[model samples]
Target chain A: MKWYQKHRETIVQTACLLFIVLFAYAGLTKLLEGHLFYDSIRNSPILGGKAMASLASWALPLSELAVALLLIWKKTRLIGLYGAAVLMLLFTGYTLAIVFFAPYRPCSCGGVISLLSWEQHLVLNAILLLLALMAIWSSLKNKGIPWKKTPQGR
Target chain B: MKNLKLILAMLAFIFAIGLSFAFMGDTGSGAWINYNGVPTELELDPCQGNGNDCKVVFEDDPNQTEYTVYTDDTLSQTRKSNNPEPYIIP
Candidate 1:
């Protein structure tokens, strides 16, 4: 128990390192193949067609880069984690819908990450969400709560 | 100081990951097919090809050439030939 507690910091650090690495890689790939990424989103039924997809294409990569940067910053780590968690949750839902309902399989994410089956994509997002949660928890534990409850308890 | 160090380390890690991804490029594992002969049926995309009709050319040079792909308005795609003999299609 003592040893585990002592090594917890290291473990958390390693996990954060891995999470940052994975997201950065994914983000950069989307950035490079911006057009293709947009096309996938545009094709998605969840987006309700091309216009929304185009908007996502522009928004997603920038959001990803911002989240990854925040996760790496001590000051903004928790916020970044929450943001990433929400994004991953959305992605997981979308991928699962495609797997179960979509008539055709669109091109899998390109560049470094190739065409992954919907199931595989879901699993990847789940793992990322878990990692983000872990990092957020660790950050909160290390730093005291940022805000105090109101005297009247709101 | 410790927090700063941690942040720096995380940034370095992320940047490293991004660099690795950029280097990997396209893995070419998609549903691309290599046709051996003139394709009997070719799906043409107006946006990608030269208008509706396009011609692809293969050129050969005496010196061993590096692998490079070239595309122009007149030519949809071009590939360098391995053999010295030049073949042109009217």
Candidate 2:
């Protein structure tokens, strides 16, 4: 077996750690600056309107935090990976839509992520989505338990 | 070993939250209008010279007759100026 195959469990653990940090940071930043996040949502061309903005302002950040929590425990890590992958997929799709279809683009993304340009946001989201998919595949291959199998057990 | 992993993950999560809090910008500083009775979508300024930090106008306000421009310098006497002139949208 290759070094990576031998260390698959470790790699999955590390990826899960990365995602927990990313989601927790992103969520907390949005929650901390709730007013700014609300303003951003209100200003979005695609996501305008008081009702939509209000719903997203709370939902997006809370969802991220929830995903982080889910990833913290081994029993729920598989579900968390799915959530992260879905969220990233949605974000990536939104970015693409803004780039091609929107009359005017306004980024409602939170924190340091808002500083990135549309192209950079796409690249970053794509990378994150790929990582999330890989994590899910690894977890499934291990039957959702990312532990090494003993020779006798195998 | 499991406890160690959990502790490390918790520490990393806390550290990330701390860093994000430290870098968070001024909240409620940007200008925004409630899109309650807007008829048409307003244009967003291309944000010339300003790096991603700016405000946006969503729609025309039927009740608002004057637009207030807030300057950054509080010491400057013209901190809040009311411009009654109507905006010409080209």
TM-score of each: 0.63, 0.73
Q: Over the stretch A128-149, how does candidate 1's per-residue lDDT look in tens digits?
A: 7787676667666567543445
DockQ of every predicted complex: 0.13, 0.30
Model 2: how far residue B70 lies from native, Å: 7.3
B1-90: candidate 1 lDDT, tens digit per residue: 757757665676657565756565443321111234322221211112122222222223344232222333322355332222221111
Clashes of 1: 0
In model 2, the runs with Cα more than 4 Å from the true position are A107-110, A144-154, B27-62, B65-90
Docking class of predicted structure 2: acceptable
Q: For model 1, state the Cα shift of residue A76 in Å.
A: 1.6
Question: All predictions: root-mean-square deviation over Cα?
Answer: 11.7, 8.4
Q: How well is candidate 1 docked (DockQ)?
A: 0.13
Candidate 2 per-residue C-alpha lDDT over A1-154 given as tens digits, one digit per residue, 9 for 90 to 100 = 5887777778888988999989899888878877667766665556566787789879999999999989888889889999999989988997887677766555444566767888788889899999999888888777754455556653
